[model samples]
Target: MEWLETRELRYFTAVAEELHFGRAAERLGMAQPPLSRAVQRLERRLGVALLDRGRHGVALTPAGAVLLDEARATLDAAAAAARRTRRAVEPGGRLVLAVKANGAHDLLRALLDAYAREPDAAEVEVVLCGIGEDERMLRDGRADAALLHPLYSSLAGFDSEEVLTEEQVVVLPAGHPLAARTSLTLAEVADVPGLPAARWPLRDGGYPPGPGPEVRDLSQLAQLIALGRTSTVIPASARAWLWTAHSAVPLVDAPSVTTHIAWPPQSRSRPLAALVRTAVGLGRQA
Candidate 1:
């Protein structure tokens, strides 16, 4: 086994993530040749071929795939160490909380208000992230904690407290035939002519193949539903944002969404603990 340097791990991670030396080089603000050389050096030091290069372009070898995950963990730890050190030296530092901008509306409002009243609470800076971004934000030190729903967000690698749980609902245009229904089953909402359920982007940035419109955020989906172009199933709390032109029917068979206050397991920050405590207390009340 050989000792790996942070620089080499960083270089390898960039290439592996982009799967293109040119793009990775541009992202790292360096020349492509040097970036390629760095990756080659890392592979040689590890005594394994990392990337498979051919006419089709770069693909990670089995070793490269393993190294990618390990390298990301290394980089995230380094970033977290730096961030914590800075926060420790600074006075009156604020704790950042990440959440999907459209999700966790009610829970976030209550958590913020309650946390504000805590005598030991530090300033809470909310970071409105895109779907599936909260985990990265929490792991990489960009956020101290996140409000995430387990159904729609990955809660792996973090310690969490369940903050809210609610039934799911099918959101539809007000004039839709099923809008008058008191409750709906998954089968009942699966296929609707001209109102296909909106497809959300997967973690990989691509939408699943479907006839439905691809949507990136809640507002976009809401607009599409308003226009009678799409429908979607979401947590019941989202009903708070529906317009008069929109309607929601309880999805009796849909899985409940449990919103949790999640943070990196390695975190030992006092402000973060206070915020989590506040969220847990409020969750119990709910």
Candidate 2:
């Protein structure tokens, strides 16, 4: 078998994603016949049937499902390579760091300050992302690095350095009965009557099954907690974002959340390395 070229990979990816040659070709700005031929040739070369064409439209075989993931990764890698190459030639290219707007505020500030003092450190641009958007930003080359919490974010394909590890806490309304407690067990906090656990949206834009109010950000969660509509477990450091109406109690049995400076494995930028080193040193001092 011959090595697959980028063009063929792109064509196959479009078809695999759309599962219809006509739609895929339209999206790719090409005619349908050539797109169909290109896919057929790729299958022939790989000696595998990637898709099943039927009257009901098209479906991916097991092999197609596997290849779709691989092809997307390959395209992301190629795009990153192009972006990095261009940035390398440009003078004073800034490093973009993605982070949740309401998380790790102290750690983020210290990391930036320390990195700024380093010799030849690059200017950092902070990209404040929503919950669960950090990994996608890193994978697609939108960011040079990210401050991520492993408990709430996926770290599947990145190289990361642990920055801070802390216990969890439950945030509740100050007027709630549980506010008087200095500390609470996970079971106690989770079973509070009339206070359901706040539901957060998953990466796929769907909320987990729950009766509580759906929250998209820390501000929303804090509001719901203040109104006595729901309660939530979060990293202990997130207490900084709570308002006066909110009270936090350490959850004794809750899992620890580790904050990490994560980046794609394929990133070879020097500025990103300097920032990661600075973050690790700060973590050590904490």
Candidate 3:
């Protein structure tokens, strides 16, 4: 049996992740041909083919799929070990915080305070991930911790904490009579034709990069209702996140949106308690 080194696993993982040799090479800041050769070498060492080359791109083989997970784990453990070593030397290692949606910036700020207050003076790195990206980052160990929506909990190996409960809102056309109602109710709009539930593109990225704008001004969402055809229901936090003029009407007694804090089930915490406390506080203030 051949002994495997960390470097090969790292390279292989990136290639598996990108699924395109060129893209993976670019991500690693290396040239494509060598990256391809390295992957070839790894397959030779392992005595198995890991990828299925393709005209469009590449796909993982059955062995490649198994290897991808193992490769990711190997890289994660190595990274974790390096971080621990640095912290042992300097008593401070950078933490990566992955959050769903940018509005969680307040929580990030609180988390920073908590980390800074730690005796080790740990460094915090915050990543504002799209709605579904948090769990992947945590399990892969790319991020030290994450604040994700509870709905995304099925991501395999992560545990979640219910950190915040938020209210809902009714978004109406700017000129709709309901917009003048001061307060809105879902029951009232249930029969009033179209309510914008948003077909949600089968993929929820939270906010897409270089947005065409999700709500594109609540007034427009209201206008969707104003089409006198459809009404929109959004979380009250949408007020915090997408407030634009008198475009959305707040509702009462609606189901609260739950925000979750997530991490790998077996993950450790540097200043976990403080981080949780600060997260709760940020939610309260919202």
Candidate 4:
């Protein structure tokens, strides 16, 4: 069998995702005819019908569905390799660590400080990201490592060590009646009158079905809580950044969130290993 080109995989993936050759072509910034031909050639090369073109529209065949997944993974890996290669040759390459904004809490600072004390520690560049973004940054080589929460991030493709685990608290407006409580159960927090649980964006950028306002980041959610617009359950450590108008009460039944230091297994460099070791050491001390 002939080796597949990244270009072919890219074209096929676009078509598979859009399910319309014309749309895919537009997305690729090319004409429809060539894009259609490229997909056809790929189908022939693979000896499989990747798409079914019925009168309604294009749909993926069983083989196409499988190929789509494989193609996406292959393309991501290729892109990651290119990025890593470029960064490696640059003078004094630094390690980039991605963390969700306000997600890491205290562990991030402690880890950075501890790692800096190591011999010849590379300069660390920290990238603050939104929910569900750290994993993408790590997978695409935009980051050498990421601090991720298993509840909000996927750890399927990386090697990770749990650095911190803490229970959750319900953050509410300081003036709210519930805010006066010393502690509350999840059920009590969930049905607070006029204060719905804030809806967070899913990986696909859609909010879960809820009556509360959708929030993109911790800052937004914090502001909303202060204004009595919404409430949310978050890791206990997040209370450090709560607004003065906000109150955080321990949620007795809320699940604990575990923060993990994750990195692509194949791209683990010396600096990344040292950073991970430092994080693990901190976890043991906690």
Top candidate when judged by TM-score against the true structure: 2
* TM-score, predicted candidate 4 vs. hidden true structure: 0.92
lDDT (0-100) at residue 211 of candidate 4?
Answer: 89
Tell me model 1's lDDT, rounded to 2 decimals: 0.87
- The order by descending lDDT is 4, 1, 2, 3
User: What are the models' TM-scores?
Assistant: 0.86, 0.94, 0.55, 0.92
Candidate 4 per-residue lDDT, tens place, 239-277, comes to: 778889999899888888999999888864777788899
**Cα miss at 219, model 2 (Å)?**
2.3
How does candidate 3 fare on TM-score? 0.55
RMSD of each: 3.1, 1.7, 6.6, 2.0
By lDDT, the better pick of 3 and 4 is: 4
Q: Please list the C-alpha lDDT of all candidates, in the order they appear.
A: 0.87, 0.87, 0.64, 0.89
How many clashes does each candidate structure show, in the order listed? 0, 0, 4, 0
Superposition error at 102 for model 2 (Å): 2.2
Index of the highest-lDDT prediction: 4
| Shift of residue 131 alpha carbon in model 1, Å | 1.5
The alpha-carbon root-mean-square deviation between model 4 and the true structure, to one decimal in Å, is: 2.0
Clashing pairs in 3: 172-222, 173-222, 194-230, 194-231
